[model samples]
Target chain A: MLPRRLTRPRITLGSPVQLLLLAASFALAAYAGVRLLADDWFGVALWFVGLALLHDLVLLPLYTIADRAIVGGLGAVRRREWTPYVRVPAALSGLLLLVWFPLISGRVDRRYRTATGLQADVFLARWLLVTAVLFGGSALLLALRVRRAAQHRPPAAR
Target chain B: MRDPDAPRLPSSPGFWRSPLRGPWLTSVLGLVLLVGITVLFVTGLVSYAAYNPNLSPVNDKTPDKGILGFYLFAWPTSPHWLYRLNQGVHVTLGITMIPVLLAKLWSVVPRLFALPPARSLAHAVERISLVLLVGGALFEFVTGVLNVQLDYVFPGSFYPLHFYGAWVFFAAFVVHALLKMPTVLRNVRHLREEKNDLVSPRPAEPTVSRRGALGFTGGASLLLFATTAGQNFDGPLRRTALLAPHGGVDPGSGPNGFQINKTAVYAGIDAAETGEDVWRLVVTGRTGTVRLSRTQLAELPQHSGALPIACVEGWSTSDQWWRGVRLRDLAALVGHDDDPPDVFVESLQRRGAFRSAALRANQVADPRSLLALHVNGEELSSDHGYPARIIVPAAPGVLNTKWVTRMTFRGL
Candidate 1:
C-alpha cells in the first residue's frame, strides 16, 4: 500500500470514496431514467448510451493497460518511476481525448472542421514520430548515466 | 521480460525509454485500434458517396435522383453481424487504445512545446492536424457512449454519429493519415531494423512478463466481448416478422428521421413473379454479358452479415441477410475481381443522362457493406429487391441498388 499522502493523488479501485461516487452517479442516472426526466426520454437515453461509450469505449481500457504496464513491468526500473511515467500517461491521455470533443459531440458542421480541411493520416504519422523521439531521448540519457557510473568507479585497496 | 534484480527506475527523471509494459502496450494498442476503427467509419462515408453519384454534392439539389441514395444512406438490415463486429472493433479499440496513445503523447510533450514549429504554413498545418486527432479521439469516446444507450433511452433513434458526421470524420482521418505517412513508414522501417521490444526483453525486473499481461488482457477482453455481445442478441424483430405491417408507407419500417419518398419507381418490369427465363439478373458493363437465373447466381459462394443501412438523411434498420455473392466475389465469378479497378451496376430501366449512377467497388469494400439477397428469414420481398440489392452500413440510402440485374467489371 502506498502512503496516505501519495495515495490521495492516485485513484484506487474499490476505495470507499470512489465507490460512493460511483454509487451516487448510478443512483442518479437510474432515478432520472425512471422518474425525474421521463418526458425528455431522448436526452436521458443519449446520456446513458454516452456513458457506456465513455467508460467502456475509452477510459477503463486505457487505465487498465497503463496501470498494468507501469505498475508491473517497469516498476522496478526506477524507484520514482511512478511520478514521471504517470505524467506522460496523464497528460497525453487527457489531451488526446479532449481534442476529439467537437466531433464526438455529434456536431459536425457546427463544431468539427470538415474532412477536406484536415488530412488525418498525416497527423497520425507526425504524432508517432513525436512519441518515438520522446522514448528515444529517454533511452539515450539512461545509457549515458550508466556509462558515467562505470567510469567513476574508485580503485579498490588491492 | 523482467529482471527481478534490476533496479526500478523512477518516472520523474525520464519520460522516454519506458519499457513496453502493460500501460505502454495498452496505450499503443489502444491508439492503433482506435485510429483504425475510426478510419473504417470515415472510409465508409467516402465509399457511400463514391458509389451512388446521386448522393454527390453535385446532384444534391435534385432530391428526386437522390431517392435511392436516401435508402442506401439510412436503412439497416438483418443478420447484423457486421454491426456487432464493427461495434466490437470500435468500442474495444477505443477503450484499450486511449491510454497507450496518452503515454505516447507524454513521451513527446517536450518536443511539441519546445522549439515550436516556425510560423510557417507547414508547421501550422501539422499542429492543426494533431489538435484534430487529439480532439477527435475524445469526441469519438463520448458520442460512442451516447450511441450505445440509444436503444434504451431514446428508444427509436439509435444510429451512431457515424451516419451524421461521416463526411467530417472522413476529413479528420485523412488529415491525420497524410501528416503521419512519412513518419510511420520511417518508424515501421525502424521497427524492422530494431528487434521488437514487444517480443524480446530489456534487462530490468525479470518478473515483468508481457506474456502474462497479455494473457490477462486476452481473458479480460473476452469478458468484455461476452458482456457486450450478450447485450445485443438478435431475434425476429425484423421486418420479415412484421407480416404486412401496414403496406402503405409503413412508417416503422422506414428508418428513423428518413423522409420517405413515396414516389420511388418500383421496377415496372417484373415487380411480381417473372417466369424462370426472366427471373435472372442481366449483366451490362465493360464486357457486355447477361447471366440467366438467380439459381445460377446462387451457385456462387455466399456471404451474410447483419448490417444497418445508414442514410445521411438519418434512418436505419436491422435485418438478417444472406447474399449469394459479394460485389468482389461476384466480379470474380464473372472473372473481373482481380483485374478491373471499377465496376458499374445496371437496373432494368433504360439508361439516360444519369446512366452512370450505379454501384462501384470502393463502396462494397467497407466492412459492413453488403449486396443482400435475403431479409428477415426468407427470400427478399419484391418491394425490397427480390433477387439482389446492395446494403451498406454507414452508407447513405441512395447507393443501395434494388433489382440488380447485371454487374459489369472493367478497368473503367
Candidate 2:
C-alpha cells in the first residue's frame, strides 16, 4: 500500500511560530531594560507584566511543543527525517531583540512602570546570563553523556 | 615544608591524584599574581581607572598608561606599545586565571554538588553567596565578549553593573574563601610543601576524574585561546573590567570615582553675565514679597547670550545652550544684585521622590556658577531646562537646577 500523505493539523499559531512568539516576549523584556539603565524608571515596571505573560503563556507552550518535536524528530531521524536538526531559537531570539529594540518601548509611566523597567533591564541581563550558563553547561553535559554512552556501547562488527 | 594543615602526598592511587601538587602550585602562584594585579588596579597610584581621559602626556593628549620610560597612547592614532602591553597583560592573565579558577572549581565540585550546611542561617547565606558568585563570574566573562564585538553590537547598557556589582561579587568571593578555608589551606600547604598533620603522607587527589578534570582544564584553555584570538564571548567581564576607549578616550575613565563626563561648568548658567562684579542671584522673596510671582519686573532689560552646556554621560554633542537673562541683570530690576545670603531655586517639577542637595547664595554667586542664556551658542535646549538654569561646576551635576522657574534669596 502507498504511504499515507504527510499531513499536519491546522493550528492558529504554528508550533515554530509559537516558539518565536515566546522568544519575542523575552526580547521585549530585554529591550525594556535599556530604558531602565537610562534612568527611565517607568519602563522597568512594564517588563515584569510582559515577562509573566511570556513565561507562562507563550514560552511554556512553545518550549513544550519544541521539546516534544525535537524528541519526536530525533526519533524520526533514526526512523524518518534522516537529516540532522538544529534548534535556532536562541539566535533567532537574539536577532529579534537587537533589531526591534529601538522600534518599541514599554509604557513610560504606569503604576507598574518603575518595576517593569528595572525588571526588564535586569531580567534581560539575567536571562542572557542564564541562557549562557545553561547552554555552556548543557553543551558540556551533553558531550560527556554522549561520550559516556559511546564508551558503554558494544563494539560494532567490521 | 611541614605546616600543620598540609595535604598528604599521594601514596594511594585514586582517580584525582594527578591534580594535587600541580593545582596547588598553580593556585599559589596564580593567587599571588592576581592579588598583585588587583592591588595595583584598585589603589589609585597606577590607576587604570580611566583618569583624566582626555589629558594626554603631550598637550591636549589623551591620558595613557606610562611606565619608567615607555608610554601607551590612544588607539587608532599612535598605538602605545606599553599601554597595549598592560591591556594585553590584564587580558591574558584574566584569561589564564580562568583555568586556575575552573580547576579550583573542579577541585571543589565534590562539595559543590552536595548541599552545603543549609540548616544554619550562616550556611544558607554562604550557599546563596556562592550561587551569586558563580553566576556573576560567568556573566562577567560572557557579557564582556558581547561588549567587545565591534560588528555584533549588543545594545549599549550605560547602567554600571560591574561598577555596582563589584561589591556584591567581592563579598561573595570573600565568603566563599572563608567557607573553604580549611581545605584551601590544605591544598596550599601541599603545593608549597610546608607543614601539616595528616592521616598519611601522600599527594592530593581531586574529586573529579582525570577525564572530567581535563574537561575543565581543556575548556578553560580553549576559551582562553578563543579570547586571545578575538573570539571569546564578552559577557560580565565587560561590566567588571575596564571599558574600551571611546571618542578618542578610554571608556570607564577614573579608577573608582573620577569620571569626567560632558556635564560641565556651563550646563546651567546665564551666559549673559560678562563680569562677576555685576553678577546677582535673584532669590524670589525679599522682606515682604515672601513668594514672588513672574510679574515682579515688566520693564527690565532682559538680555540673553548663548553658552555651552555639557553633561557627563559622554554625550557631549548637543546644541542646547545656557539660555537665561542674567540673574544680576534681572535682579537689578527688583532686588539687589549683592548682599544676598541664600538662594533657593525651585524645580518646575515637584521636588519629591528624589534625592536633593542644596547650595548657599554665596556658593551660587561664586560666579563660576551661571544662569546661562544659550547652550552651544544657541537657544536653550528644552530638555536641558529651556527658560533658565544654574550652572554649578565642580559641584555635583544633580545640584544644577533645571527649568528654573523661580529664584529666591533670603538674608537670614
Candidate 3:
C-alpha cells in the first residue's frame, strides 16, 4: 500500500516506528551528552568510551587468560571437578575488590578519615579476611564432596 | 559477500568459542536487568526528588534539569523512614546487581565485535544504541561506586554528571529493551538456544552447565548484599557492612556514637562562631527578621521527634531522639499562622556542599519537622551540628542543614 521509495527502504530493515523510536533515543542521548560535555568533556568522553574499550580489549582478555590458566593448572592434578569451588571464591573476591578497590587499597585514606572519622586502613585487612574465608569455606565444601564421592564409588572402579 | 574462502577475522563467527554464550543465557540476564535496572532507575529518581530540586539554585544541584524534572514532586513526609528505605535499597541493590550486569555483558560481548559493523541502517542504529547502553551502564555504575567511596577524582560535580549520564543511558536502555523484548520472550519461552556465533563450532570439554554459571552470579550478588546491607542499620550489624564508607564502628561512644557524614573540621565550622554566646538563629518572613540566641531558641515551646539521618551516600543512623521547636511554630512566630510556605535554611558551614538548603511547604508543616537543638538526651557535639540543626521527616541528610544561622520562611 505504501509508495515505492518508502517500501524499498523499509525492506532493508525495520519499520517506520522502529526508526522513529531509535531517533528519539539518539536525540535524548545527544541532549544528555551535551549537558555532560559542557562541564567535563574530556573526562566524560573518556569514561564513556574508554571504559567499554578497556573492558572488552584489556580486562576481558586478562580475566579469560587467568581463568584458562586456572582450569589448565587444575587439569594437571586431574582435579578439574574442583574448578567451580576455586572459580566461585575467586570471582566473588574479585568482585568485592572491583566495587571497593578505593577503600581496600587505602587510596582515599586521609579524605575518608577526615570525612567519616573511621580508618580506611581497616578495609584492606577486612577484604583479605573475607577472601580467606570464602576460599577456606569453598575448600572445606570441596573436601567433603570429594570424600562423599569416594565412598560412593564402586570397588571395581576404584 | 562472495569471498567465503578468505581467512576469518576476529569479528568472524569462528573467533568466539564460548559454549555458554547463547540467546538463552543472554535473555535470562536481560530479564534480571529488566527488573533490577527498573528498580535502580526509579529509586535513583526518587532520591533526586527527595532533595526537593524544585527549590532551584538553592537545593537543586543539577542545573538546567529542564524537562527531566517532569516527575519532580514534593517528596512525602508521612513514613519518616522513607528516604532511608529508598536510599538503602538504591545503593545496596546497585552494588548487589554488579555480578549480574557483568555476566550479562560477558554473554553478549561478541556482538560488540561483529564484522562489517552494520548490515542495514536499522542494524547500524541498533549497534550505536548498544554502545550507549553499555557505555552508559558502565559510566553510571563506576561514577556511583566511586562517589560512594568518597573518591572524587572524576571531573565535574557528582550530581549533574550522574543525572545527565543516567538520562542518556536510560534512553538507550529503553530502545534496546523494546527492540530485544520479542526475541527475549521467544528465546526464553522456547527454552532452546539456536545455533549461532555464540555457540562454539568446536567446543572444549564442558566445565560447568549454564545453570551453574547463573547460580554463581546469584551467589555473588547475595554475598555482596550480605556485606553491604548492614550499613543501613545500627548496633552490632553495622560492623558487618565492611565495604561501606560508614560501615566501621561509630566515631565515638554513648549517645553520640552514631555515624556522622561530615566532621566539624571537615565542614570548616569555626568553634568561636558556633559558641552559645555568639550563635544567633535569625528568622526572616512576612513579619520581618527576628534574631534569637541559642538560649532564646531553647526557651521556645520545645518539641521532640524520633527521626533518622539518611544520607544520599547510602548510610543512615538509627532514629535518634531529636528535640527542638517545630518548624511550623517557627513559621507562626514569623506571622504565618495558617499555612507555611517554602523555607530556605542557611548554615554556618563555611565549606562543602549543602551549606544552605530549602524545604517544601508540606515538609515545613510536618509536626515532626524541627530545628533540632539536642540529640539523644544530650546537647549536640560540634561534629553533630552543634547549636542547632534542621530535622525534617523523610528528607535527605544533607538537606537537613546543620549549624543553622538563618531561616527565611515563605515568599523567598
B1-412 per-residue lDDT for model 3 (tens digits): 1236543665766566667888888889999999999999999999999988887478887878888899998789979999999999999999999899999988887788777677777888888888899899988888899999999977789999888899999999999899889889988897564666676565567788889888988998999998988998889889888778888688888887789888888899999998878989999999998999999999999999999999998889889999999999999999998999889999999898799998989999999999999999999888889999999999999988889999999854
Query: Candidate 1, overall lDDT?
Result: 0.42
lDDT of 1 at B314: 21
Give model 1's DockQ, 2 decimals.
0.02
DockQ of each: 0.02, 0.02, 0.65
Q: What TM-score does the first chain of candidate 2 have?
A: 0.35
In model 1, which runs have C-alpha deviations exceeding 4 angstroms? A1-158, B1-17, B21-35, B42-121, B151-169, B189-223, B230-412
Comparing 1 and 3 on lDDT, the stronger one: 3
Error of 3 at B36 (Å): 0.7
List model 1 lDDT by residue over B1-412, tens digit each: 5446453432222222334442334344444544655655644444343334443332232233222234454223323334434443444444444444444443333333333343444444445444434444444444554443221223232232333323223344555555445545555444443333232233333332445444434443342233233222223322221101111122224222111211123234355444455667765444456575877776766676665443232223344454546666655555554543455555453321222234445554444555576665567654455567766654444456556666666644
lDDT of 2 at B131: 54
Which 10 residues in a row give candidate 2 chain B its minimum summed lDDT?
Answer: B242-251
Ranked by TM-score from best down, the candidates are: 3, 2, 1
Which residue window of length 10 is worst by lDDT in model 3 chain A?
A6-15
Model-by-model lDDT, in order? 0.42, 0.37, 0.88
Share of the reference A-B contacts seen in candidate 1: 0.00
